[model samples]
Target: MLRHFLTLLVLPGLVVNSSSSRSSSEEEKEHDDGSREKESNGHHSNGHGVPWGYKDQTAWTFNFTDCSGKSQSPIDINTRRAIYDPTLPPISLEGYDLTDDSALTLWNNGHTLELILPNTMRIVTGFDHEFLAAQLHFHWGTPEVPGSEHTIDNVHFPAEIHVVHYNSKYANISEAASQSDGLVVLGGFIQIGLHENENYEKILAVITDVSIEESNTEIPGFNVRHLLPNKLDRFYRYNGSLTTPPCYQTVNWTIFNDTITVSRKQLKALENTLKAGQEEHLNKNFRAPQLLYGRHVLASFMASSTIKNPGLGRMGERNQSTEQSEGLSRGDILAIAFGVLFGVSLLCFLLYTYQQHRKYTSITKDPRQNVIYKPAMKAEA
Candidate 1:
């Protein structure tokens, strides 16, 4: 009985030690996280420390220093102020449809959800040079706050997706990132609504798998075109930098005017699903709009056109022969109809006047007609 009592006492001590060790380990982990966050907020002796792109950093003032470059990005796209450049060609996205499972890896990079794509994808034309596909990522905010990086006329959207590419003229994406005119990013706005955006299902369904920071999963390749707006012709273009830092000023941005829809539930999944540390979810991952300075924002569509009558500018340059067959506007057709009717009426009136003059001449001047209708005929009648 004494031995049994001693075993029980020892067992309680062992349990206490085990609990204490676990608690200490957890605290140590938390401390490590806190230290990392603190260190990242302040500048390190070396150039690299925490990712300079993180929004959570509070100490280092230098994180925003790169943001003040001459050509920073996420500017407000004032459509009215934008220049209508007919030279801005329709952007051609090559190999956007990925079917091989081995080509795709979806990851939660702690800051945002990123997808690794194969280099087979590319931008054939649009800019002065060709840009090869690198990868894609997202920026989003909570349900209440819209989080798109680039705003339209200062209006924000629920989310945004950036399809990043590198100037193929350079060796690779990393090499191109620091050079001017070395990157081209296709930005698409994401709006929340009632119906499920079928195109978003590929990304949304995988959110649960990578709910934690640094978590990743290999996904079967999907049609990447679905992620973009249906109308790629109309877009806002400008010279800018990566919204993230080392805020490279190499990016030539093209933000689509058309917005893709995401269901409210999917947006909730995005806002609440991914987490940075054990503390909380990734709420706001977007940087606010940067200043334009003296930069020009060019548009692919004509400025005179409205959203209802949006012009598909000069498709002939991209696709040969076949034009955008949407046909003329009602106003254009009406003008043509009025022009035709005026021309026909004028012609008919001229012809009737000519005929009357001809008949009068024949009656008055023709020898036989004159003999019949002259004073002799009147006297006979």
Candidate 2:
């Protein structure tokens, strides 16, 4: 009958809705993967068939121990909850102004686009010792999904660039990567806008040459400073690990508050680029942010205002790092100066009143003049 047919259709819809809710509820479980036992016991080739990608991070071989580590990278930076510490100084780049073309090379690591720099280029300050620049890479998503590894206030940016470095105190990157505070990574957010960042274009121009995995090419070396934001003082600092495999918890992360603008054309080039051993475009090359787990995110500069959740495409309004990053603002300085001046004036007034009262008491208590003035005159005669 017609009624029976309609009931069948309604039952299918009800079942689909129930399944969808179950799926969403499963995802809401804080991203905790309970299938570790099954994943570990399953025999996959040592490195050949290791299923490593953005879709399933448990398949990564190096992350067996750190998959559930307390300290992880690409965390959500809630600026409102960050502590403003003036002691965090502005990062100083030592040899980033590379005029020598021989110093730079571009390569397509299976995961992201990478640019290798010489050890001469290093982060001179912002740590107990210097951190030598090893390499820099980017993570991005498609036009629809923002792929930045780290998010601000749970809002994802179009992309993110990580400048990886090794601590100078260590012999090499291998040794530094295992120790605490051994690595320093400078993170900068990228946003899609109308204008192109000519500085970033230097590396993007060679996207075709390194289109495949393990492919690399030479590029005319430019100033590495161009890759970073103009302001480096205002940043969120925290202790975290690398996002990829071997998630070592040794990095000192400094993610800038400001963002660099890139054109849609450039973003397309990044998104459409091919990965190694894949015909499809390498899109959504980012990891979801992990829980904070009570980690403290320190800020170099005091935030003037709170950024609303999902504040994207508003680079101009973001905090800038400058000379005033660690010091009090002009208004704060004036307020403190006024308070000190008022306190000093009040103390001076109290001292003057006490002196006047003492003088009056001394004059009023001159009883010798009243009783002894005449006796003293007779004695003198």
lDDT by residue for model 2 (151-263), tens? 99899999998887767886544445445655678889999889988888988888999998757787877888988888998898777766764344445778999888899
Q: What's every prediction's RMSD, in angstroms? A: 16.9, 18.1
* Tens digits of lDDT, candidate 1, 330-379: 56779999999999999999999999999998778867753545453355
Best candidate according to lDDT: 2
C-alpha RMSD between model 2 and the true structure: 18.1
In model 2, the worst 10-residue window by lDDT is 22-31
Candidate of highest TM-score = 2
Q: How close is candidate 2 to the true structure, as a TM-score?
A: 0.67
Report clash pairs, candidate 1: 41-60
Residue 32 error, candidate 1, Å:
19
